[model samples]
Target: MPNVTIYTTMMCPYCFRAKKLLTQKGVKFDEIDVGTDPGLRREMTTRSNGGQTVPQIFIGKRHVGGCDELFALEARGELDAALQAA
Candidate 1:
């Protein structure tokens, strides 16, 4: 499996929903709580092409955008392949 990372905030429902979906899919991830750390939040912004919002997800080195984008990808049957790809 590729390295999965998610930049999230504690009170974001989208963040929680994203996590629930990943967990249901059995995808392990490294979560960075940007709400609690200003440095990490900036890092998230830089890594996300200026998207400072919560739930910026990366599968391996690929930026997968936010929760809605993720669901859209899943709906298109692309997310799993991207996640499982080498």
Candidate 2:
């Protein structure tokens, strides 16, 4: 599996949902809590190309946007392939 990362805040429901899905799929992800750190939040924005929202996800070097996009990938049956990609 490719390296997975998710930038999130503690109170974000979307973050929780996104994480739940990943856990269900047996994906191990690096969770960065950007709720209290401006520097980390800025990093997330830069990494996500101005996506200033919680749960900005990355599978390897590919920016997968937020929770909606993640779920959308699963709906299309492409998420597993993406995760398994090198």
TM-score of 1: 0.97
Per-candidate clashes, comma-separated = 0, 0
Over the stretch 21-84, how does candidate 2's per-residue lDDT look in tens digits?
9999999999999999999999999999999999999999999999999999999999999999
Q: How many backbone overlaps does candidate 1 show?
A: 0
Among the numbered candidates, top TM-score falls to 2
Model 2 regions lying over 4 Å from their true place: none
How big is the positional error of residue 12 in model 2, measured in Å on the Cα after superposition? 0.3
User: What's the CA RMSD of model 2 in angstroms?
Assistant: 0.3
Candidate 2, residue 25: CA error in Å?
Answer: 0.4
Model 1, range 1-86, lDDT digits (tens) per residue? 89999999999999999999899999999999999888999899999999988899999999999999999989999989988988
Using lDDT, give the best candidate's number: 2
